[model samples]
Target: MFTQDSKRALTAAALILATLTCGCAFESSPRGELGADQDLLKTCDPAAPPASFVQIDGTGSSNSDAIAAERMTAVEAIARRTAVCSGYLRVTVFSSSSAATAVLFDGALKMDGATENARLKRVPEAVSDVMNKVRSAYAPAVQALPQSGSDITAQLRLAAEWKQQLGGNYCLDLTVFSDGFQNIGVDLGARALSRQEAERLAEQPAVPKLAGASVVVAGLGRVAEGAPPSAVVEGLVSYYTKLCQRTEASSCTAVSDYATATR
Candidate 1:
């Protein structure tokens, strides 16, 4: 019933409306609720992460053997040793239980401190399962994982970022598995944190590692020592890399004893 001109005008108006509606995501996505400021509208930023102490209730893993995760602690200890507050670094090896979804650090574990985050990606389970046998072993000191893929990554990646940013009061409970290490490696770390980044973190005028970091480390400690040859220790230390910085001295540890003896 409308004239041709009116019809065109209506179509144009509709198109403009659509554009405006989509504009919230103009920078990217208009998914999140409308906000007064751009920071509030950011959809990429991870949500608040939990930060409570978690102790691993690993079944088959023993405490004597020098696990690769133990050596990872030594790697992160560099900043602390140099009198820089790089926070606590916790690591767990899904070495055995390939499907084990161990607990990483949360924000609360940061214990009232400034935090930042960068989740590298593919940290095993999308949502860590607290109901696992391991968690059951370490009861009364834990928080269940969020019921979303993003929440899981955001929770952990932010914690890692929190470590990089604040230094003190930070923790990184990495569930480094054999296959999972294919992406991240010593080279990736070198690329991510060059000498410049190291100096920046080391030179920062702030707190020491432990004072602010009432950190708690957790893991299933499940790297099957079942000896066919290499599978057991491979969980703790991933030797799977193509263009990696290979060397016996590299902090990308293989086993605790070998690394210790070499050191």
Candidate 2:
């Protein structure tokens, strides 16, 4: 009933309509667009991410299994929190000299997209990878007791330097896992210090400049051996509080456990 030229034009229009329908379907399907959404995370802003630094004391005191387990749990929690906002998290082991300190883990959380579907599908896998790396990096620290003395100040200084290097208005959250027994300099374990003495000691030039940073000193009184009396434990807390204040920290919390170290 139709002419040959008319039939040919009708066939061409059908083919074009089919192609457009396929394209539309592909765009609307989750499976088809997941790859493209993932690719977007690769270009996320690096400099503006909130920064978190954790310094674990690798000295003999913090080498026990219980402490290691607690540290791992705390680090996992921090990783999860950081991932929610696509922030940066760094873990390091303390050394007597800041220059000699070892970096355990350094990573930035990546998000596929702002949509809930993208977050649910991608964030869990990313967080799992981060925890795996953190566990791997932390293995060697608990294998054997470190020979080096604990230098809490040096680690703080190193963190301050890192924050400076970041060079932005990004907030820095510092968590220190230690027994608060400084043996390298200005011995904190020598005697129970009064609040005034602690403040005076923190005024020394050796203290790091941590202006605008929030600091949490966890496991402050849980030493490996010769556990100090209540007075000494109180002294340790006071010393760290004064020290954080001296460095101009935004907030300071010296607590005995990671569960209570939240800002």
Query: For this target, which candidate reaches the highest TM-score against the unseen true structure?
Result: 2
Candidate 1: residue 192 lDDT (0-100): 30
Poorest 10 consecutive residues by lDDT, candidate 2: 19-28
lDDT of 2 by residue, 61-136 (tens): 6567767766776676556545654767888877566764677788766566678466736766876887787778
Q: Write the per-residue lDDT of candidate 1 for residues 148-170, one digit (tens) a residue.
A: 11111222233344456644322
Taken over the whole model, the C-alpha lDDT of each candidate is: 0.25, 0.65
* TM-score of model number 2: 0.74
Give candidate 2 misplaced runs (Cα > 4 Å). Answer: 1-49, 114-117, 141-146, 260-263
State the lDDT at 178 in candidate 2.
Answer: 87
